[model samples]
Target: MTEQNENGDFFLKYRNETLFNDKNSIVQCLKYFDKDNDQSLDLNEFEQLLKSLFSHNGNSYQIEMAKIKAMFDFFDSNKDGKIQLIELENFWFKIIKPTLFPKNALLIVDVQNDFITGTLSLTNCPSKHNGAEIVPIINNLIDTVPFETIAYSIDWHPADHSSFIENVNNRKLAENSPIKENIKTFDSVIYEAYPNVLQILWPAHCIQGTNGAKLHADLKQVDAKTDSLGRSVIYVYKGCLSDIDSYSAFFDNCRLNETSLHNDLKKLGITDLYICGIAADVCVAYTSMDALGLNYRVIYIQDGVRGVDSDNIKKQEINLVNNGALLIKSKDVYDMVGCKDRRPELAYATFLSLARSNKV
Candidate 1:
């Protein structure tokens, strides 16, 4: 390689290392990157400073420089070539302190194929809300939303699960001579899943090892790629037992057992939860309510969920609203996070726009 190319490669490599540094405390970072004793950072020093503050994995030099320039311009109030101590302080206060991206989590509930186009498809459901539609919206959210943790719940059930009406009818037939070929969906029956527990049967769905049990092909997991900003991807499996149903991601249908979801969120120190996914009236609603019961703030993305029953969906909305769940659309999420752009002025302006929007 030529001398000029080699010089460029060295600077790029140095920049990459600084960008991915896990060092805590802005003061320590400033001292380490500041090669000179001067308290102020010149364009080169400022570039290094900003890069260290944010994560940049394998970004091209041109792109990284462009982003650095935008951020420098945002903090450089006097347009002086150097960013002084005051500017550095302002950067920390405005950009870093206000947006602690890792305190929030995105929870997606039951976006499996069974809820979409499988035998128990929500499309064939009473509301006829296409569960597949949520895949793209949620995939987009997974990319754009700056959440610390991302969690998904899948309904994985045993073949002879008690919630299945087929199982119930068979049990009844064994007791009596015969019965109707099958009961309609949503019809209740007193079947003995437990000694005295009356189980409300549902259409057989999400059996383990079945196509219906898998998450949708289009649904993008937060950490599908190494470059994904999503810190962790947690999968919570529910309704796996043959004798019980599980609607809430955190607990079984009878609240007899709890999933690892609660402990995971607690371990991550998550304070706010943003939820979306299939069957808004059932799984989504149940999970949101459970989150509320745990004293965590909850926001339900209305456009990102479909429902099995239209009337039950309306009722669930009323119940959720009454019990303190913020109902919002997908577009409002940008404002909630105050924009992922590193430019402080633009981020503040976007936040102000949402403040005036009167939707929050």
Candidate 2:
């Protein structure tokens, strides 16, 4: 078999020989890679270890010799030419374990009643897709996928939120605003108060404590404090400030203010994010983009999202893919999470992260 086709076999062999073997500890594994039996890993032995860890799913992974040397030097503390058992253990726990078994999270964004069947219903938008159609699809993922963390983002807007069309008169319109009179919903206007704050106006919806702000009744809500499965549940409330609008769960549109989502996921050591929810071109797209920016492996569930505009959604999908976001189906998530159906794209993403960290 070619080197590419041998990747799966190599991984299985490595798992059986090193990871699953009860007799082989971290020190033993390091010694096994020490071809000369010198009790420590030399530069050549170290390169072999990194190659095996990086190559997965029939991908012919490659790295410059200079980078491999840098990695070896990094692990070889005290300016030692060889990697000892102590150094190998640190590398195994910090890098190898995370690469092999990543912590995954399912991020459900803005699946509220208002976007589904109320004032800001997507059915009335250009695409006219039923926003409620995604609820069952997302619920199935929640029930089946064994994700380490589940996060639900809510658009918790105040009654006088600036994005509301009715509240247009509340803020002074910027001089650059195109339409000043007879302001309508879906109109993009720049507000003078925030200094060039361009916002898309929508009907009054998702006000705090209102039925519109609540998640759809059919949607499954996991309690963060008491999850039966011991999974971490997080609720991220965005657009809470009346003056600024937050499309991404992590940060506001201007990126001036941040929510608790990034730190929450970081606290749990989440490495991958499977994002799906309403308005694919808006909230879902923004969240996915931000997740990518935050160095999270983003897998977007294609069928589990509904958008306001078909053209905009297509454009956003292309943009996401160009920026390293993986577009996947809901069905593929189970295997991907379980590591049964490994993807080269995700593997490459992980490699890129390690390479960029300058530690390897």
Listed per candidate, the RMSD to the true structure in angstroms reads 13.1, 5.0
C-alpha TM-scores of all predictions:
0.63, 0.78
Per-residue lDDT for 1-360 in model 2, tens only? 114533233443444435633434676677667889888999988866766555545443465687677667776876679998888876766556555677899999999999999999999999998988999999999888889999999999999999999999999888998888888899989888776668999999899999999999999997767766678899999999999899999999999999999999999999989999988999999999999888888999999999999999999999998777889999989977875445545644544566568554
Top candidate (lDDT): 2
Local distance difference test, candidate 1? 0.69
Give lDDT tens digits, candidate 1, residues 278-320.
8899899999999977866677899988998889988998898
Residue ranges of candidate 1 with Cα displaced over 4 Å: 1-102, 170-182, 193-198, 339-360
Per-residue error for 220 in candidate 2, Å, reads 0.9
